[model samples]
Target: MPLAALVLLLLTGTLVPINRKFRETPGGIPVFVASNGLHTDVVVPTQDARTGLDWRPLLTASGQPARPAAYPFVAFGWGNAGFYRSSRGGHTPGVGTTLRAALPSPTLLHVSWCAGPPQPGTRVAALRISAAQYEALAATIRASFQADSVGRFVPAVMLGYTAQDHFFEARGRYHVLRTCNDWTNRILRRAGLRAALKAPLAGSVLYQVQHVPKTRNH
Candidate 1:
């Protein structure tokens, strides 16, 4: 395979959701269009039915549509980097300055992904959880774990196995975890959110350890 094609496949394949068909933006970037193919999957539309939270129709500063609905959590993993790259870089031309720049002023909550080591050149996928949904998810994590430490559970929840052949080929777990960390840190800084929210941050290293691959005991 050609080097550029190999790189593109690695970046997109690992990042794009596989259980559904994708629709590309005018910029030529592919997006997780809908939740299909996975027979028993849950489809949490970008527009929450009950609350009418339509994150799907969010528009960039330049008036370009930011298609958050294209990718659902059950299929596309929840890491911030993809969105950061897509919004900040010129990937979707005239989209916005960055995810932060495009957000409504006085932004209550924000998500971002930081470029790291390999840099991956440009980010490929992205999504945003509504304030209500973010709160609900945070509450669930707190209730289940008895702490509001979101950073801790991020890796295990977002990163996992995927059937792709590229940089993400056999690299889903670590890649996801790494992307999650990059995102968590960036958002915390951008929103001026404390490392520990509502409770003293605890068990951080243990949280990072979630990336360790498991093995059968001898």
Candidate 2:
């Protein structure tokens, strides 16, 4: 049955990762995976130490209440465009909007700034990866952005949930299979980090990080 197949897939996805040997290199770039109970985001610095990929140029901070660029950490999240833009956690989205997200739909990149690292708890986990790995991860995030004619990430018209954060057009489909957590896991895999093979849920990815090779050097 379809329900049985989906259950099996979720079980396999939760239990399996692309690489069991993925190790968190000693003295690697520090990053954190932040989850808001249901959704996940990859948190990095304004400028990566290895690649020097500055997001200051692309993100909007003009006429804002806070200076996002000055923040110590930046978090990147991807999800359904309409859901993300209109969502304030104030109320659940309408039936139509929720149904649309169940299908292949437009996605948006949610870029938010954090003053400090996410506390290592159930909702937040930290990882240390090599410079090469960090750069690769950053590259993947960059590629996820929907580029313009000149290959630039345009800021979405909708105002951000916070003064320091803003939304931008992103390339991907937000559906049952390709959820926000799945995108985060894919980025980790591309960067050679410990990531679930199919992480459609935030808990799936968070649980796998606990099994990654840890180093005291971090």
Candidate 3:
């Protein structure tokens, strides 16, 4: 081969990847985003009245029949289980980053975005706790929020997953104010906890509000 041709061939081989990413729909979840050689899928567990275990097509907040959030968690689930990601075919995006329990009895799992870019003064924060620990955390949150009725629920637990990495960190680090809005936020603000962090975090925010009944029925 000519010298120039030989050099070009070597450069091409080095630049191109050996394998390309394909979409993966493990567990029957649908894929949402596909980019930079990555596949992501989000599944919200649902059950059919007759079938026992069936998947209801996921929908967006607007109720306009939209796909799940793409890439890094487009939205946060109320509890601690669901999130969205991009998809293409069968290959999923790499294990972006994840925060999970220490095994044997994992409680919570936090999937993460790439970590190199470094947010100004933040790092990914994931948490996992045992049943006891979760209960304890819930109680602490109720106390912190000064929830009207602590006994109404075993600490109305909710997970705040954010598409923006900063929001995720803030949710992990700040007080109830950072994690909640409206009445919940009002309760936290009145409790004297600031929203933005001034010092380091002592624990995660536990935001709870009384589920008062109005004239309308459930």
Candidate 4:
């Protein structure tokens, strides 16, 4: 019975479009969703002068320098900490680690410095949303960061690095029902953009974003 139910959930989640309206934000802020085949990230401007979200503090806390002038965008992603911290040295986690992550485990927040907006391709999708939507999304992302009493982001033990990317402690639990892709989808929804209701896989989330018109007008 459990196996059957699991299969049903996957089937339904994979086939259905969570939000098919393709609604456009009225004068929305431009944001980008980036994917590297297996994982996805939400990219936003480093400092929204209007919203007053200076991401420099978060970057500094993670031991990353402030965003360079050429790279004005910051990318954020959430995932199981064990999978992220242990999947180093080209070593895949065993069944134990995988099961722990699949059943509500601690999570990590990944922040990266981006050169600019995501380009339309199999690996990236872009969307433009209103300032209101952007604020809500920013709040949601901010709430995910685990901070100290002084409100500085708590850096996670070093797992690995990729160019100008770093990871930090993140709030919330990660499970099969709320994977990294699901996190991205939720952030997009907070920004009033169309996204899959339950995107367990990166491809599932990217598939929905890919269908939307890539032009900024939308």
lDDT (C-alpha, whole model) for all candidates: 0.25, 0.82, 0.23, 0.79
Model with the higher lDDT, candidate 2 or 3: 2
Q: What would the per-residue lDDT of candidate 3 be over residues 181-209, giving only the tens digit for each residue?
A: 22222222232322111101112111111
RMSD of each: 19.1, 2.4, 22.6, 2.6
For model 3, give the 10-residue run with minimal summed lDDT.
Answer: 204-213
Number of the top TM-score candidate: 2
* Model 4 spans > 4 angstroms off: 25-27, 61-64, 89-96, 213-218
**Each prediction's TM-score versus the true structure:** 0.21, 0.91, 0.18, 0.85
Which ranges of candidate 1 are over 4 A from the true structure? 1-45, 60-62, 66-70, 73-133, 136-218
TM-score of candidate 2 to 2 decimals:
0.91
Model 3 TM? 0.18
Candidate 4 per-residue C-alpha lDDT over 1-218 given as tens digits, one digit per residue, 9 for 90 to 100: 49888767765675566557765564566678888767789999987776677788766865655656677888999999887776776577678888888788899999888777777777887777667778888989989999889888888887446767888889999988888888998988766677876687888887787777545446
Output the better candidate (3/4) by TM-score.
4
lDDT by residue (tens digit), candidate 2, 120-207 = 8888889888888888898999899877787767777777876768888789788888889999999998988888978988999998
Q: For model 3, state the Cα shift of residue 144 in Å.
A: 1.2
Per-residue error for 107 in candidate 2, Å, reads: 1.0
